[model samples]
Target: MKKLKMWLPFVTLLFMLAGTLTLQAQRKQGVTLEGYVYEMDEDQKFPVPYASVSIASLSIAVTTDENGHYVINNLPARNLQVTARFLGLEEQTQEVDLSKQQVLDFVLLVSNFRLEEIVVTAESNKAGAATASKINKTAMEHMQLTSLADVMSLLPGAATVKSDLTSVTTASIRGGSSLGTAILMDGAPISNNANMQIMSSAIGGSTPSTSGTTPSIGVDLRTITTDNIESIEVIRGVPSVEYGDITAGAIIVNSKTGRQPLTIKFNTNPNLYQGTATHGVNLGKNAGSLNYSGDYSYSVSDPREGYDYYRRVTARIGYSNTIGKWYTNTSVSFLSALDKAEPNPDDEQDVTIKRQNDLGIRANTKGTFTFNRNFFKSLEYNVQFAYTDRDSYFYDEATNATVAYSLSKQDGAVLSSIQGNKIYDVNGNLVTNVPAGEESFIAWTLPSQYQYDYTVDGRELNTFAKVKANFAGDLGATHHRMVIGADFKSDGNVGEGKIFDPLNPPYRSVSYSDATQRERSYKDIPFVNQFGLYAEENFDWEFANRHLQISAGIRYDHVLNFGGGLSPRVNASIDILPEALTLNAAF
Candidate 1:
């Protein structure tokens, strides 16, 4: 019995050791902790490529790949503390309970400045990108930019000028016209591509010529106001093939989004006043979250104490959310403006220019999907629609009433030799003219003879859509990213004008009505369609702990109307003294 008792104790210990060993072996059966690292970008989130994720307890750390994905194998199933960090971003720490193979995602926020011993994200500080600039909310607030035009003027080789106090503002880059520069709001174009000018002449006379001057010429920067804006990105030099119909450059604007503290803002100057409200909150995991922003602004060119001559009102609202792997955003905006024609002192004035009304509306929607696939990392799509309407009226003061002037010979043929206010006598033959009645016709004056009342109306519709895919992989010793996209656009314009000239004295009569005296109108609608396909490849080689980097990229764009354009870019950077000095070159 004593021997059995001793044997029992030894047998119990052997059994216990065997059980512990078996349990550990089962737990270590190739378990792994894997997930992706992302950064919160206003309304949506994007992967932070090359982020650092570590576990101090296990003395193990790994850097994310191009798609922000990482995996740690053979980790024991238990609670652990994990930390993720990136340069110019706040660090994040989470308690992850690794039971079996677990998936956990980290969302980090952007920091105000770069941190020491931090790894930089691929898209944020592309070491070899030569012509990319970022303007954060802090910089925008410091500059107090009122419009996108103001933002572009601060860039290299870009300029925006206002000719007069009431004149509209225009933008240009590197001596390129505004038409060549693509202005983008949420990755879609917002430029006007139709005529909005109105011109008319007497019932039968030639149309009045204003020397080709038109209202709302080019992309009117004055119509764009900065409200609830988060950041702006300017691409000046060679850009990716994903962008089309752009020869000069591109400006991309991003708005505030996601859950945030509710706040109200108000600002004003001598001629401008603005107010805004913003809010953000979480709404569970399945239902996603919401972020919203709304703002109103009023501006004037002539705010003479208590009186205002020209004024404009603008309002906008934006919303964003994320559900599962899909993220969506939407926005709506409105604009209204009024202008009074400047009076001429030399011309005898009885009637004055009436108030003109210009109104516009715009809406946009965008969505993105993140997936783990063999060929693509993510898919993105965007759609936009916009409309504009305008109206104006012009009349003569001297006639005291709208009138139409007409001239005819005794044989009933119309005459066309009237020069200035001087009229010539018409003979029986259409080509025969005499000065016998010149004094009487000249005395009648051109204003009274060719007076008329007219009105002009114009409208436009614009729409755009695009789909793109992003892919990343390794080729040889270099990292590679490929982008492919297709885009389509449509623009249409409609305009109408009506003119009525009434009866005047001996030189002009409406009842007998010569060929030139009558009522007339004009109506027309023009449209344009555009389509494009593009592809680009970006590659980089790193050596010696990132002490030297060489990046090269090439883009191919095929546009329906513009044929094809090829853009090649190369950039190199070398860190000489760690964080102190770096040499960069681009071509």
Candidate 2:
């Protein structure tokens, strides 16, 4: 009987243990995943189709449908890793515990350059190359950039200054003038070195560039609005040979393409108002896609106060497609802008008076082609046509415009004698008057009273074409990447200025006061053609399974107008504890 009781207790314990395990297994929860994948288009978000979704733990995978909806069932009740990937977008991963059904959404973005967390020591296009800084669309939205000039101030080693009188915005980099810094949209350069002004006797040579009294240089960014910019990159380090005419640095802008959804946005503040709309449509696998965008912005220093404001309107359309190993992208855009400024009545003066009514229009077409299985890697071409018309004049609100003076005597003398007030001409000559109270009399201090209007017209055309090829091979134990490219560019400008002359006497306006001012003009049209050929070779050797890396590159460039030169760059990285610590140097 003693033996039977001992055995019975052991059997009962085993049964209970088995029953507990069965109940636990039955109580385990199931995992089901349901969510959508979205792609961002400026300020709007829309679902994406055919995104690959996979779970590593369960060995299950699926693709999102046309509506960007995905559902996966029958996953284990444990922590699982899920990965989502799409072409032309950054891959994303998520962690989910299958203890219950989980709902998760993913957003994907596109970028021209990708870095997986590496410190840059030298100039390169790859990860950890040079001092390249990128401003993505998300960052652009957060910063609320109003114009291209605002972007320069955000970059390192660059300073921006705005002219309060002329409403011109320019930038200087690393103590260098704006002329040395190159601004490029896409792969082409658009530099404006001309300062349009009425080059005639009535206005004299009062243009910012030609006048010793004012400070304004290079292209004016105040007229460019930030509606269609997808991203911007600033290369602060030694740039590649592909970029030329730049002594300081370069700014590259990439416009939005057609791989996005439709979006609309409205933004406003006390001094600024903006509206934008963008849309994209997929035609077919063989036909490609279409994209369109429109943006308008109106900015004022103070809406309730003085006349200091500008308006910009821009529109863009693009098409992109891929067939076999060939991919093509083509786009066209137009810009219209106006900048105006009026000085306060008290601060207005004939010698230093500046009131600008600037108007401009620009149109450009750009096309790019990439070949995946060819000796030539890519080809790009751009054509730009633009015109600027300005009607700026010095105005005197204090004087009436109905005055008609006799041609025999100077207007200042006649007016002074009629008003019975002693007035001085621009030369400080004293005058005495006998009559009093004339309605049409204007003081000699009013500059606008002597001239009709100052007008300037400018037209510019630019074209760029380039071809690039890359080679990758092995040299001993080191890997070599070589890039070779050639580019040709032409820039031409034609403009006419009226009523401005710099060589005239100091008292020129007053000297001709007795005669009706006849407009004197000048024309200066400059044309420049630049051809460039460049080659770069990069060699990388690694030790200890990539724990230590040494990279070096040398570049040679031949510029048709600026001559030729050679630039060499070197970089190294040592991983101390894998992802935890890294030591790097570049020169």
Candidate 3:
């Protein structure tokens, strides 16, 4: 009985080895998969290049070539789920046995419904994904949005506020400052860093109420029209390293594209009237498409107060084309805004008239190049340039009873009376007045009820450029998509700032207690330059009947005067019940 027991143990080990060998032989019997992906048009088939073909179970994916031909090697000879997808088209999935049929072709159809037509409300991402919300054109139309600011109410935890264009409006996310949120239009930044519209505060020249411009805070949402927007995506969670110069969150705006019929809309409210026209034209065969849009709006604080009004006009032209393996889109836009507030006819004493004008032009080009290679997937680039000219004027009647003002750009107290009065220094020494347009360290008290006007002219320019490369491949059982990119930006202003008569400078207390305002030219300030480098990796792994997705990235930024800063981020999610439940975490 002892000898039989030893033989039985050896025999069991031999059987186990044979079973393992048989499993290895079955795995080696893989088949090659080759197919063509195309679209049908009136019973005719045309190749759909750059379409994605993937096997989710095995984490294998590939893109079709220019001829819509795709090939996958060493695929398991068993039943598998294959998916094919492309932009602006319906996705198709099928289950088939590779051993029986190696060549699997797909015919994709154009989606009949627009994304906005189906989504009537704000749509959120799945639980396991990043915290994001998307608002489409249909939602904006339904809400009768007059400006981009009105769209903010659609977000969670936000209350609807009546749309008003008479005042400057900015966006704030997560209770953070407006500067912390980054606003992007078509992947290009809408920067307000070089806005120097405020008058020299030393002379009691604060921001004018009718300026309608936000300086040092962020973009003024009221200036951005919503008629030409296609979609808006707000990211409240930790965003990808591709976005920088932000701490709270990001708002991405995508403009309309492709071929569409002409659309004209007119809207009227109690305080606002807006009109917009948009059209898209297809240039036939391989020529691509051209799009044009224009919007005009006028608003007043009250129907009876015609003296205070706001006017805005915007126009845009865009071109989209695909040449060879590269696809490019270029656009140019123009904007003009005017805000004016005049004195009422009944008020004889108050002659204050405030007017602000803003003119801007922006141009941008973005392109993508696809490559059918083992390691490299695609390359993307974007370049943008923007220029804005702002003019602010404030006119008021000053009635000083016994106030002494200074015209001296230097420090120390110098006092003078009306035009005929003598000037004196703080030490009670006699000071001679210089001729007009000459240097004089003296102060003068102006006549009562005189005209006090000052103008601030500021010209700002901004430029941005970025280049990124994407790579996709399989390493062992994991599929990875890696992205590496670098971006640079520059902002500067060159304009005559705070223009005023030296003889009758804005009234300010001549006492030592009050801070003095000095004349400063916008061109004197230095330009700001920023550079950033980023890298990110997104991977998917399937194990033990569960799927895991993780994204990890890091970024480095260097400012012209400031030192470099580094930021690291990670986000992970795991499916617990296939499509039913998932756990997500981010840092």
Candidate 4:
């Protein structure tokens, strides 16, 4: 009763606010804008589907349909700046008087330039929007990146770190822990939530030296290749309500799509060698485009010793098409990464071999439907599924001078010799009999040398689905673009957890006197499910030759077997000198 009462006021306020906006939208006068976008080649013009047409000043945008047609209704009656953009094409902008005209058409030209002449830099987002940096293909090529982690150096206030594939690296945004940052590729979020690769609890404080796998933190950047990436956007400020379960920020990676020429590349450095190939094919007049890419890289920690090394291979297949009023893009990707440390024969005391392997496959589809309705502009949906298999192995030569520990999990179990087949409790009652290749407990004398090894197998599966509707309208002098959406996510692991010989287990930790190590399967763990709903209102108002743009939204998340909460956010900006300067704030 108390909790419901506490939330009543907030609920009432939300309903009232929505009602007021609806009423104002119904009373205002609005204009409808429609247009077609095209590409020209040698006196010939062809419709360009999925081209973006937007009003920069008003923050209203729409995508061209299969026939290269777009319709945006309820726009304010005034002069507006409109822009058109498409992949691999030059952008076009024009000034138009919406009060006098209703139809606009644009013919975009193919982008022509040599790669060597292009400047490499991270471009910042425009004023009156969330703070972000974008890195395009030109910049990525100039840097000669070997992995996705190399892009971090392009961000502001970030220092370059030498690339080393032998170590695991996770992304950290704005001084926050890596776990708080969300990484997404092609509108689908990558998840490491189901990773539980940990040393057996019975081993206690004996930590193993492992690399290339991040269990509790986040996705390992070393596993992601940059050869097929088209652009990357790092959002450092508050993101939209559509993004959830994040505290630091989000990293959005867009892969290459559409028609393209076949290209192959090979790069070699002192410690790294990489090869890549990418191509795109037009399936026919209206069949769509097929794109594919492959990458392989090998790196050594030290050229002299070559004891520690890393190897990665990646492949991707993508398809983009427009069927009627819907535009869809689908892709499937595969990755395999291995990190290993070989034991050097010269060092007799350092006989150890450690290896970590990561294998994964992902499939995703994103679609958008443009509607010609008065208020409802478009609907978008995304579905993604991913599975990963991880294997970690450690081997070492163990030597103990004078210690013998019990292997029994019970706190007060008796320690018996290996010759004994039966075990008895303190009260002289029979407890249990030892099985083959096993002992009741540790009863060795002193000075024992043995070989120890352990292996962990982890299998993770993640699925995500989202559907959202976009609305555009006008309320008096304010132009509005709103989004309402819901999403579902599920993460789980099913694998044969830790596997090792019970007779020759790793050395137990001295710090924990009563600790015991035992094998455990991960298949018994429960799946984590999360459902989220969000709504956002973006509006721009003009008065006295000044423009004000504000974006406000709220999100609700419910986790199965756990509680839920609400998060509200707002970002506002006011022009101080038109495009020259602006003031922005968020909460």
Candidate 5:
């Protein structure tokens, strides 16, 4: 009986397989629609390929392809009901009368709730992926109370992280230095000081420091309160045309839209000597959002590191609105910092004492064309502009210019200024080019920079469009799900630089300031740009009953100046026990 038990089950399974195929074959008839199944809505004018589609009462079914189009050459002449499904979207159904040759199409609306599909679980934003690895720095609300530098540390590949008492923090991303990846906030490009990893001032002037001096800090990621954020998406490799330059990958950060009711909050961090308050509210029947926030901190360095000190303040005010098919966002911000550079007694051979202060403002705007329910993914266009003014004066044991536009008694280096005692001789006045002489004394020394030392003022405008996917598909589903998009970025910059002419008063002096004075002028770059196209796919499979997952994707990047190339990514994961104990690997 025991032998018969095992043998019987095996015999039964073979017959079941034979029966299943025979039934499937019988259900298919000549001159019938035998391709994959699909569901579409008015927003999408094509098949929802790779999506599950099957007859509600029968086993007759097939999945769609990369084109969102399906092809089935045979099916019986009978009335049938088919169901279709895609993740994060609603399911759909269609009824067909096979008696008469026919073709049917469907459009599925977004289901109000998606989380309802899975229950009783520890939820994390970083869902397991089959191909390529990803780190979702998707923080919200209280998460913003921290710095961007602090947030990046939570990723698996970025295990090495350090933060001083200040806001600046640094980490390693996928074995690469922190500088390897590009960082952007609300469409604004962020750059860290070449020496430390803290953010530069918002206006390109004296930006505040988050931590102590080292690694020349970049922008402090922690300051952008997650409350005002709408979404944060980062893709590793798998480069897309929509994002170019800075090769590793791209991180897309978008702010919140005021579609909900008013919200207000206050936050304080004693560790960094900071306190902040933020407010957000929607207006009019359209429910546009208006948000504002401010923060200030005073930081004192550890005696062991140095007597360095930092004080900083920053704020943001913005509005968001949607009109018909167009949506727009605008904001203005202020950032300032005062740093103390105690006298360098060690270099006293040329002993130097210095202190610098910087203040500036930045403004930004974005507009987009959107299709709420369209299938080709919503289309978007964006534009932005900014201006910055930051100036500073230096005083050494040598000199200080107390006058406006005067080159006298100043650390020398001026472009447009005058000084006294025009030395003269020769025929009547000095004949040689040296305005000043034992040597015609035309002027002394000018400030090394009239626009304030090391300042950057920028103005830029950019526009681009991209396609997005609204759903996720299974790995072994024998279907092609992808992201297809393209975009372009156009930007330019202009600012002032200091020049010295010893023959002219201001700059002639070895003195630091305009003992006399010289010349200064503004400079600008006409434009810089990026453009390209991208697409990717995830493969599905079933191996040894262990939910196998795999994904492979590639993209083509095209730069006008350097041309184009392709990048590929492969990833896989195995289930030790269904959903738990997952062993994932990627390259």
Candidate 6:
């Protein structure tokens, strides 16, 4: 049955070939013309299934689908003409020189614009112009977008600047740098740039080949569960004031809600990172929804690029009111450096080794409060926080040099080797299996770190907030449907590195403190604060029974060291059709 199924198509093709050959021999005339038709508007936009095309002579024609896509087969090897016509639209004709088994696509134009002075509006596909915005609800629903950079890379006016952390998170918008782009979760800004986003700062020790950071402010993208997201709004350019100082773009994500009924979902699939075991369920009173989903998986593969096999795990949970006005979202995810590929630390040595014992965590939470519609006027406010921490030990740094190493500790010699280790916590809790030096081998140093050693329990925090009005009045004659707003972001990191300095020890010997190299340690905490305001508006003009719309906005930002800045944006669309297809662009 399988073989027959596979050969059926070929058999049909062979029969068609034989028939064509015989027919050509019998009557010197044999021709087949085929093509698909698209009814385009005056602006050359495909209106999608609103028009019809047909061959008047032979009654052969086909219409397109909602996506403005179609395919027609069996065309001729000679010249052919096609006529396309739409109701309440202009009729058109096309001529083509057909070749053997060819496909032709068409673009038709409508005579009149779809939106005229009709005195009434049907449904707002979210616009008054004849052009439509491609709402990709399904696309967002299927992809678990992890970074603001990843989301913006696929949008217009923006190109993601990638690096070592592209998979973890790294991005740039338009001509602006990654740090220059404003990022927001809900309506609040995301800050703590040095850490909130991962940076490949060296692992400060003898083994400086690997990279990582102490517990610090990092964006937690894994917590955003696709199943829990209601919608993800991507603004590829400057957005409205209801936003803040972002010159490039912004992404507004709305989480799903109404958790009265219980539901469950799960998956078990093997991937490059790990095999996944995911589960999601909802539990709440009859009035609201409280949902939770978690994932645990393991992955180990020899990537062609030689990224040694390793492991990872992800999980999240969210809660909302079914009948009340309160909501909360909280989740945590982890990535332990199971292993990696590395080059030998010696200048004369050329070998790759597998590294292990790297670990990190990310956690976030968002809480919201919505007041009543009357006196409270539907006031709603939200807050979210994120964190990431990592630690590892491998050749951190190496200079070109060679040394002999056979001296004893008593031979007035000093020799030492160093390995890197890390302890990290996300949000507020420390993760497991961290190697903290023994209490007896502890000491203290300050400001920041490297040695003689002391054990530390540390934590870092980042906070974001959002506030919006259910109703906002227009500001003046410009139709400034103004949604005024501000954002508050804060980041804090505190910890110390233990350092071990030599003390008149043996010179050029390997047995001196062979297992104990940390000398002293100290701790330092750096925190940052930022704020901004934003605005946006829309304008429309009617001419020749068509509408020309212009959308514009601006943002103001105030960072700590970078001072402050303002960026403006604009988008326009002209109604070149009757139904709703516009020529749109934003800059």
- RMSD to the true structure for each prediction, in A, is 17.2, 20.7, 10.8, 4.0, 15.6, 23.3
Positional deviation of residue 73's Cα in model 1 after best superposition, in angstroms: 13
Question: lDDT of each model, Cα atoms only?
Answer: 0.57, 0.55, 0.75, 0.77, 0.44, 0.40
> Candidates 1 and 5: which is better by TM-score?
1
Off by over 4 Å in 6: 1-169, 172-177, 180-192, 196-230, 242-247, 254-287, 300-307, 322-378, 396-399, 402-460, 473-480, 497-525, 538-545, 548-550, 560-562, 574-587
lDDT tens readout by residue for model 1, 498-544:
33433332122333233343222333544667776555445555556
Residue 301's C-alpha lDDT in candidate 2? 70
**What ranking of all candidate models by TM-score puts the best one first?**
4, 3, 1, 2, 5, 6
Q: Candidate 5 — what's its lDDT?
A: 0.44
Instruction: Answer with 1 or 4, whichever has the higher lDDT.
Output: 4
Kindly report which residue stretches of model 1 are placed more than 4 angstroms away from their true locations once superposed: 1-130, 153-166, 198-217, 281-285, 305-310, 339-356, 392-445, 448-454, 497-525, 544-587
For residue 290, give model 5's deviation from the true position in Å: 2.6
For candidate 6, the TM-score is 0.50
Report the C-alpha lDDT of model 6 over 1-587, residue by residue, as the tens digit.
Answer: 45445545644553353344334323322344434556555556554342344432222344444344444333334445566654223456677665543455666554443433211111112212222112122343233332233344445444533212213343354455445455554445555353411222112213222232222423333223344344455544445545554455545565443321232334322323222223333342232234444443233333344444444444544543323334445554444433455553443453434343333444455543443222111344556665534333333212221223211222232322212323346775443231244212221211121222112222345676665443211112222122335667776654343221332111121222222233222225356777765544445455676766665555566777767666555667777884567676666
User: Candidate 4 lDDT, tens digit per residue, 1-587?
Assistant: 46446656755665555556656656653788888999987789999876778764443567677788888777666777788877666668887788899899999887654455534343223322567777777677767787878887778887876666767788998899889898989988999898877635465647565556657678889888888988888988777788888888889899988766787899887788899999887686668888899999989878776888999999999998877667789999999988889887678888899988989999999988866354566788999999999898889877652355556665555556665656777999986644444453564433467788888898999999999887666666777667779999999999888788866776655556555676678888899999998877777788877878787778889899997788777778788988788788888
Model 2 local distance difference test score: 0.55
Candidate with top lDDT is: 4
- Candidate 5 global TM-score: 0.51
Taking all chains together, each candidate's TM-score versus the true structure is 0.63, 0.61, 0.78, 0.87, 0.51, 0.50
Using alpha carbons, what is the TM-score of model 1?
0.63
- Winner on TM-score (4 vs 5): 4
Residue-level lDDT tens digits of model 2 in 1-587: 45445445533543453344334433442457789988776877788775667653222456676677877654445556688765445557888766653888888765333354322222243422445676656555555666777776666545443312124676566667787777887666766644445334433222222211111466666655566676677766555556666667677787765456567788777777888888777775446677788888777777664466666777788776544334455676676665555555565463333454545555555554433111122344555555554545442222232323331223344544244456687999865432344444433443333333234444445566666654333333444344556777666545554543321212233333343333333345456666765555444555565555444444444545656555555556677777678776766
Task: Show the lowest summed lDDT stretch of 10 residues, model 5.
Answer: 118-127
Candidate 4: residue pairs that collide:
202-516, 202-517
